[model samples]
Target: MDTASSSSNSTMAEFDYLFKLLLIGDSGVGKSTLLLSFTSNTFEDLSPTIGLDYEKNCWGVVSDIIFLFLYHEAGQERFRTLTSSYYRGAQGIIMVYDVTRRETFTNLSDIWAKEIDLYSTNQDCIKMLVGNKVDKESERVVSKKEGIDFAREYGCLYLECSAKTRVNVEQCFEELVLKILDTPSLLAEGSAGVKKNIFKEIPPQSDASTSGCCSW
Candidate 1:
C-alpha cells in the first residue's frame, strides 16, 4: 500500500481507477480511528467527526486505485438530512460496530443498513460488517458468531478489527477494494482523474509489521 501527500494533477494521473467508500455505524464505534489507522498507520483518541470527514487514498496491489472515503456521523439525528447525499455514488460501505457495545451491533441491521439500502445509488454496493475494538475481548458483548450471523443475514462480508492494535485494519479496506475491483458493474464506473488537493504524498514503504493485541 502507498499514500500520497499531494493530490497534484501528475499524482492524480497515476491512478487507473477511482472508488468512493464509506465508513458508518453508531458514533464512537471508532470509525475515525479505524480510518486513521488505515491511512496513517497510527491511532489516537479522536473526537467524534463533525458533519462528515473524508480522505483520499491511492492504493495498489495489482494496479493503482484511488479511494475516496467518507466517514459519516451515524449516531446523531441532526446529521440525518445529510446522509442521503453521503450515500450517493458509494461503491463500498464499511458498517462498523464496537464489539463491546451490544447496541452498536444491533443498530447495524436496524438503523445503518436500512439507511444504506434506502439511499445508496448503487444497488450492488459491496458492504462489510466490521466489529471494531476487538482488543477489548474481555468486554466484548458481541461474539464472533453473532457478527458472522449478521453478515450472512445482511448479505455482506464480516471481520473483527482493532484500530489501536492495527489488526485486520489494512485487510478490511484491501478486501473491500478487491471485491469492488472484481465486480463488473463497479469496475465499469471507475474514473482515472480526481479533484486536485485532496490527498498527501508519502514515500512508499515495505509492508508494516502488525503484532500484539492492543499495543501500538
Candidate 2:
C-alpha cells in the first residue's frame, strides 16, 4: 500500500462531506477488528460494543456522519431504536461478516430490510457487504458467489477481503466512497429499473446491524 504521505494520497483527499459508514454483522464477525484497522491502521481483539460505537471520518464527498457499530449481541428492539435514529442523515453503510460464517451473511437481508423501514426517507442511503477473514483458507464457510448473489438480490455492492492480511481492506473503503459519489447513470446497474437521482445526494449517516456471532 502506498504511504499516505505519498503523492497518490493527496489525490484521494478530494471530496465534500465525510460519509457516515457503518461496520455491521453478527457478534464475533470481526466488525470491531476491521474497525481498528480502518480508524487506526491497527488490529486487536475486543469485546462486543456495549450499545453503539462511533467513528467519525471524512472520505470524499461525504461529511463524516457518526459511524455506529451495532454490537453483535444488540437486541432487535434496542437496535431498532438507537441504530435506527442515526440513519436520519446516513450517506452509506458497509455491512461485513466473516466469510467462513454463513449465518452472518444470511442475515444481511434482514438488516437491509430493517433499514429500509426505519429510514424510508433516506432512500439514497447506499449499502455494501464485505466478507471478512478471507485470509483463512481453511474453515471457510461462505463462498464468493453466494456473497455476490446476495448483494444482487438486495441491490447493493459486494466484495470479500481479509482485514488481518490487509487484502482489499482499504480498497473496499475506497470503492465504497466512490460508489457514494458515482452517479448511478454511469454504472451498468443504473440502466435497469432503479436509478439514483443525480440532483439529490445522500447525507452522511450518523447511526447504523446483525445476527451471526462476529468473532475474529
Candidate 3:
C-alpha cells in the first residue's frame, strides 16, 4: 500500500484507465482543503477558490488496474462557463459541504445537484455526498442523518469526513472508484460499441498499492 505524494515522478502513460472526477459545492465549503488532504495527505487553510483548480492522482485498485484521477474544483460564479464545460466528461462527482454550515449542505441538493443534472453527459456518473469537517463536532450544524437522507434522495453515496484530521479521506475516494470500476457501462469504449471487460478475469488482490499526485 504505497501512496505517492503529488510531487512523485509518475507519468500518465503508466496507468491503465483515466477517470475524470469533479469536486463541487458552495464557496468555502473546504473543497480545496479536502482535495489537498486527498492528493498530498496534508491540510492547510485555503481561501475561497477564485476560479478553477485541478489535480491528478493514480490509485492502484487491482494488481494491474491503475486509475488516473483528474479532479476539478468549481466553486466560483465567474467561472460558471468554464466550469460547466468540465461537467460533460466527468465519471465521478464529489458534492462536498461543510458540516458547520447548514446552507452549504442545503445547496448540495437545491443548487449543485441541479447543475450536475444539467451539465453532466454521463448519466451513470457516480455521485458522492460528502459532509466535510466532521472533526469540528462541536461546530457541526448539520447532522449525519441529514446527510444520509440527502444522499438517499439524491441517489448518491454519503460519507462524513474530516479533511483536517485525514479521517475517511482516502476511503471516500476509494469507495467511489470501486463503484465506478464495478459499473460495466462506465468501462465501455468507442462509438463502435466495443467494450472492455478489464477486471472480469482478474482476481482481487489484497496487496495493491495506492499512488497519486496533485497540483494547484
Candidate 4:
C-alpha cells in the first residue's frame, strides 16, 4: 500500500489553532476527490488511494487563525487497520459518501459510524457528514433530503458537494472549521489542548436490514 503527503510541513508557529481532521468513508465515495478539490481548487483524475493521503491548510488570521491538518485514509477494507490507527486526537472528522451510490450512503450508518465510535478520540469531536458527487445527478441514488435527514437524525452537520464541479467544496471545509471553533475546548490552547477522547462505544450492528436501491 502506498501513502503520500500533499505538501511541505509547516511549523506550529505558522498559525494559531491547529485542528487534526480525518476523512473517512467507503471505497469510491470521493473522499480523495474532495480533499484535492478543497486544497488545490481543481479536479484531477485520482487513482484509488492505497493507504493514506495527507494535506495541510491554513485559514483565517491573527486572533481567528486556524491550521487544518487533514488525513485522508483509504476506504478499502484491506486498509482499515492502517487507517484506524490515525484516529486518535482528531479534532474534526469529515465522513463522506457518494450521493450516486445508495450502498455508500447506507453504510454511513451501518458501518462508518461504528468505526467512528470505535476509534475516534472524542465522542464530541466536531463531525460533518458530506454527501459527495452531486454533479452526477443522472446516476444519483441518494437524495439531498435523505442526506439532510440522516444528518439531523444522527446529529452531524451535513452538506452536499460536487468536487468535480467545485460546488460547495470550499464551503464544506469552511463550515466544518466553524463547527470545530464552536466547541470551546478545541480552541483553548492551540495544539497543546487537543482533547483526549473518551470513546462512547457504538452498539454492535444487528442483523437488522434497511431496504433501499442497493438492496439488490
Best by lDDT: 1
In order, how many clashes per candidate? 6, 19, 1, 1
Report lDDT (Cα) of residue 167, candidate 2: 80
Q: Give the candidate number with the greatest TM-score.
A: 1
Candidate 3 residue-wise lDDT, 120-209, digit = tens: 889899999999999999999999999899899989988999999999998888888778777877655211134233222122321212
Query: Scored by Cα lDDT, where does model 3 land?
Result: 0.72
Candidate 1 wrongly placed segments (more than 4 Å): 1-11, 193-216
| C-alpha lDDT (0 to 100) for residue 100 of candidate 3 | 98
What is the TM-score (0 to 1) of candidate 2?
Answer: 0.67
Best of the two (1, 3) by lDDT = 1
TM-score for all predictions?
A: 0.84, 0.67, 0.82, 0.81
Which prediction has more favorable TM-score, 2 or 3? 3
* Candidate 3 vs candidate 4, TM-score winner: 3
Q: List model 4 lDDT by residue over 75-145, tens digit each.
A: 88875555445677777888899988899989999988888888886766888999998888999999899
State residue 58's C-alpha deviation in candidate 3, in Å: 0.8
Q: Flag regions of model 3 displaced more than 4 Å.
A: 1-11, 189-216
Candidate 1 CA-lDDT value: 0.75
The total of clashing pairs for model 2 equals 19
Query: Candidate 2, residues 1-216: lDDT per residue as tens digits?
Result: 221222223221232233445566677777777766664677777766555555433332233321122222232344434554445445567778888877777777776456555663446767778899998869898888888888897777887887787787777777766776574422333222333332133223312222111111
Worst 10 residues of 4 by lDDT: 207-216
